[model samples]
Target: MIYTELYITEEPSEAMNYHHEVRQVQSASKKKILHETPIRSQDIFKTLPDQQRPIRVVLTYGVAGVGKTFLVQKFTLDWAEGLENQDISAVILLSFRELNLVRNQQYSLLELLIFFHPTLHRVTAEKLIVCKLLFILDGLDESRFLLDFTNSKLVSDVTQKSTISELLSNLIEGNLLPSALIWITSRPAAVHQIAPTCLDRMTEVRGFTDAQKEEYFRRRFRNKELSSRIISHLKTSRSLYIMCGIPVYCWITATVLEHMLTTEESAELPKTLTDMYSHFLLVQTKKKQKYHEGQEMRRIELTRTDREVLLKLGRLAFEHLQKKNILFYQEDLEQCGLDVTEASVYSGVCTEIFKRESVIFQKPVYCFVHLSIQEFLAAIYMFHCYTNRKTEVLQEFFTEDDKGNKISLEDISSLEDFLSRAVEEYLLIPNSHLELFVRFLNGLSMKSNQRLLGGLLGQTESSPEIIQRVINKLKVISCQGKCPDRCINILHCLLENNDLSVLQEMQDFLKSDNKSETELSGIQCSALAYILQMSEEVLDELDLAKYKTSEDGRWRLVPAIVNFRKARLHDVFVFGGSIGSLAIALTANPSHLTELHLSSVSLGEYAEDLFTHLGHPNCRLETLRSVN
Candidate 1:
């Protein structure tokens, strides 16, 4: 496996390399860890303190897809290669997901060792235990075994017969092998399965830092220039860059970029999570086509079959995601119109699109490669049903199955009504996954995306009228809510449509609502910035004091606000928000503002920073006031 020291914590500025300014910003935000010493993956057990009750067990926790498994693999490989942790004679890797299948089977530790490691059959359980051993247990959250320590009898000897869970419990609790080393990996949600005293040290896999993200990309692409370009493009979207913190997402992103850059020049790069994953899905589908003969026939046949598989997979993803399941049994596959054999095929074609693996007794369990993929598939599934005019699918998306199945949009007289109902019925719930669903819905509404989908899923009407209605609905939603971020995202999706109607509508909405104050979310600010940049007319004055915003919102508005010919605030009251935009405007070359007025405003702790910029040499402020 390709390896890099792509994970680190910033202790001193001297210890890292990236960009100086980036390092400074990173160092300032992170607190100093004074007590915890840095431990390498291979040396994790070796560094544990030797005490009366030694720290023989290590618990490593992280969010899903944060490279915990990868780290384990790397560590294990290093040991096997005699590169690190050489003192440990052998390492046994076990997956809880696989372990679940053997929960019903009674086995002694000796028998279990033979099951997972057949080569070790010659060694007796007692001898294997006494030898230098490192046991790695992966994915505690996926395990179905009832690990009830309170009721289970504990045995220190290897010949003791017990259920799979009891075997694991005994191993971790030191009843089976007190001198042996154990490393367990789990998502944060499943960390409580082991008692606090059972493990010695608990470390979290923090994924990648900014510098590490850069390092990974650099290592991933041999073409340094192309890597730089990709990194630059990724940085343009904060949310997209944030997703790259996960190693799997980073790989997915790299996959998308490599496909787009090398394969097609005209193709647009992904800017959002939905777009990125959708592109990834397309890439995965196309990848299968490359191996087959008869390019045209293969493409069509594979595309058609892939679409069918994806639809069923999407339904499965949505249903399981709703149930908060990242892992599912073979029975779950049958429920979603997929048998184990068919799922195995998809697992190969998708290649981490949907994973199929066997558990403890060789019982198959399946899961989407990652949670985000599940969300993406779910979104795609919902849209599939919506486009197909399946009313029950709408109910499924909303998780309101009991509300009846006869529901249809036919009675919703207008497009606006249908959109409003869709938003209210589903998007308003604020499920984290729903955000991606709405984004995909909005993106799939685009004619270009629809064309792309059409190629793979057969033709469907790509209606500009429907797209406009959604844009209009989003604008309405943005102005009506306390946090208008999702609504803003919907509008952002339509930005490439080259339609300024949404922006004009937003401007009109802001201007017309002079009677009351309205706040724009961070995304709303981005939308406003986008509109301002796109607008041809150079206004003499612009004001946003009536609309309260946050630091992120203001920061996004900086470039747009600074370009205005004259910015004004006669009686507008700024809330506890950063005025960084205004400050940046003040410091710009030619500094467009001719006059400024602040009657009553609180610019938070960064108020002085804003004021200091006003005194800059390039400041064009003809008049200024800070009224008490």
Candidate 2:
């Protein structure tokens, strides 16, 4: 009953305010029109001449909780009134979420068109096709058709691009449907791989501008006193304001303020995103407690695994909260340890409060109605997961050394018995342990200890394998100097172990003349310095001329110098000699070389003279260091 009333609201402010909390409709269509124009008069309304020609489709996409659907609704309602005299036949607003419930089989576009209107005869449908019907497809990224819930797959095997493309193709090529102007909305990731031909124009719906935020705040709070207070609160709350780029965050913040005023609680308002969400979650918990009471409460009754899953989801939400982006797929969920055959971990939690009038925006592939809820959940998760016990457990698993002893594979397997089981359990229940595992491995790779590196790389489990696979995948790409700084440490580990296979693989990675060149150069310089000690012939095979010059004719020697100097040893003169040649070449023509590194070089009298020449202002070397 609560949800039914809320679903019928016409006033934007009233509908959004109490829709989720109380679900009460305040105005009818007639009253809403008289009170305020449902559609803005100044909005653009361009008419197409014919319905037979292929109509241009433009799509706008962003994250969930960013007021995308609301914007579309507002635009359509306004457009219909503004273009009342135009020959527009009808405007159909179809949500992918609604369509998913009725879709059991792979129905064609014609079948879907007919299915939505069973009363219309075939002749009427044909005539309607000739008339210009504006088709607004909302939430393409959330389309259930693209999701494999039963199999934990995100992308469809058909490889026809997006559902919109397939639908458009059916209508245009098959001649089953009319050439209608199609406007779509989806999250960024959903439409990322979609081909350019699918849509005529693609615009991104950015978060509310500051002016829009001010307008929204004024619209929500009629009382000048309350409005001023709220504005002050928002201004002081930097993180909350950043989160407010999405309009839904504004609504959530208003809701919190409204509740605070009603309860006569003038408690300190949250200043940061973490604090804001923490407050929201605490409020949610308190509200749940009032209804269920103690042990029987659904919030309190959540399993440890369930709680962990929620926390992981929360952490992800917190990280991307400022961007107001949601609508991620199973692969995205997998990164957080929630990849499984069952409904997503967050959706499952939503299911527990099914009777509540919560405005849940669901699509099969992605979930979450508001960015605030995601942030709230993420903040709670981070708070608990970073506790001392979990930290220690993560530290031991990632930091402990596993020397390459002659232990049997079976014994090693038994020792790591928890890994497969943990992964399996996480797969079934959906938790943040996998994300924690990845973060831990990432952190460990940054450490100077070879033992920690060996421990992480020695693992045979799927989780650890993913880490290696990621590294291997990264190796193939062009390094844009943006490759993780921690990767240098890993390369150092491989060099110290004399792992020629990894060294060769790294060398092959550096040879690719793609976007990752600068990164590969640094890795190469480090690996090659060590390799040169064993065989200077490898240096003869490298082509160093490519990375020598920037676009402005200035020489860039940071990558080469850093790696070469870091690997230098006091007694290793051969390594120093080979590096000196590369450094000398880098410093020769460049007049801006500020940092010079002969750090690990066992410099002879000749190398010292070379260092002095390189240190000159005309030579452009500012800080020069020679170990010996």
Candidate 3:
């Protein structure tokens, strides 16, 4: 029996941050239905390897940035050090992202092994297969070629030539080296490509537990005091804290906060995903200065080269994201005006932000370190394009309408024309990449952000007049339309601009008779949370009694509700919707609503908890009304 200790980077108990609920399917439940279950990532391999029918093929799935690769890396490192899985003589690790190169190339199992693990080239196939081997295949979703099992010609010989898919299918199906073990990692989307029958055991990476998040912060920052402060600040915003579940987001946070904390640049830290990502980009840009001691020299030479590379990468990122392509080949770089030499230089200089990976038997591919970063860069590209050419870029890049026709010249003159087009054409759809891109566009307008971009591009191109026009258009559109997330992004953009007029516009929109009975979507709730954070006056209390709100919608409002200083509801609306969110929001933040008016409202079963929160000493509620 072989076992791998999680190490946890600290004492086991110390890593336990209360009881964190992991959302996954129970191992005992044969059906694939995911539910919240309390399970530790460390305890995954605790059970012994069964002698009779050992679980040889394990499939672990997770969302991007949830630490799947990190877990695999840790496991491999531990095994190599002889601390765990000693029964396995060798661990052959391969990334499908890299394996994509050899998809068409014929190779025997022995050749494929040696191709990735060149040290085994001299070892005879018979001797290698006889020894215990564990194959860890990572990033199955990154495979360029479809793993078409139905069409693949399967072969069992270790030295026989076959398609990569055929070899992989045969290996997993026990057609070749039946005794060998396999471990596969994939994002959730690609998990179904492998037949259910092939998986001996399935596990999902749930990212950092609360305790693990704390432990990570402690390990990341040398100053314990700063780490504690960062943690405390992050905990205050539910959305920010939730994002920390992704290890990469946590790293981004640490990177941004660490720099901000040390520089004394600004007291306010990024609270939203857009702000955080914008800060990340700025941090990367500033990093080049360290190489040059004189600030003047760094400023001049840095921007010229950095700007060119960024523009090219941003173009590539934007185009790829539009096509839902995260991975790219050499031609993609050239298409974006980057040659191999320039791209390589950029990759080395921006290693923290960009990555270049060699695909065996194929040309190397390039991509931003994270998908979110690509989206951010894409957004930046859109903004830069807009700044340089105004309506021309939108006409060329966004619309397919003929240039001679000139459909709406008057509409194109408005500074926010790009925002309008993005919302109407893209962001209204579910899971739109433009959602984040638009937010990045907003964040880029900030003066401090402008300074960073100005340093890069020689000068920031946007003006306050243009930003004000965009905000005005956003407010008008958000009020008239049904897309809450778009409305929120508009608000987020306004916030980045630091314009208070949008707050009044929002207040006006909420107060409008026509807009009074609108239900807030989850995205709208998030948007409201951003708005409420910066507001001195609460947006006229939402009277959603006439609105159609689902249970999920109420939960979405929790983040927004917790930001309220005083809320006056006209009916038992929130309770009738989702009592859980109401209770959680109020309990989470005692001073949330100091003067809550539930006029003609019925408490029903939620009365006890609602009253309990109101009675808490920290609560500042001085007025409570229920006039039926």
Q: lDDT of all predictions, in order shown?
A: 0.62, 0.41, 0.61
lDDT score of residue 453 within candidate 3: 53
Tens-place lDDT per residue, model 1, 1-628, is 4332222221111111111121122222232333345566766665444445455888886666777888899998888888888878788988877776676888998888888888888988658766989889998877776577788787788988888988888888888887789988876556767787676677756667778889889999999988998999999875577666677878899998987887765667877665676677767767665543523211223445666777788889878766667788878878888766764445545675877776555676778877778877776676677666666666555443123344445643343444445554443443333444455555655566555554433345557776676666555443222222223444544553334565665577556745236666655665776556435454566555545676545544443554576654434223212223465456533346677666554555657666666556556677776775
Q: What range of 10 consecutive residues in model 1 has the weakest lDDT sum?
A: 11-20
Candidate 3 has what TM-score? Answer: 0.67
Estimated TM-score for each candidate? 0.66, 0.45, 0.67
Task: Summarize candidate 2's per-residue lDDT along 452-541 as a digit string, tens digits.
Answer: 112212223234454454344323322222212122233432322222465675466546666234443434444443333223121222
Clash totals in order: 3, 10, 2
What would the TM-score be for candidate 1 when compared with the true structure?
0.66
State the displacement of the C-alpha of residue 99, model 1, in Å, after optimal TM-score superposition: 0.7
lDDT (tens digit, per residue) of candidate 3 on 27-67: 11111122223333333334443435666787777666777
Off by over 4 Å in 3: 1-53, 122-131, 265-267, 290-302, 342-344, 347-349, 357-365, 390-397, 400-412, 428-431, 455-469, 475-628
Better of 1 and 3 by lDDT: 1
CA lDDT, candidate 1, residue 92: 91
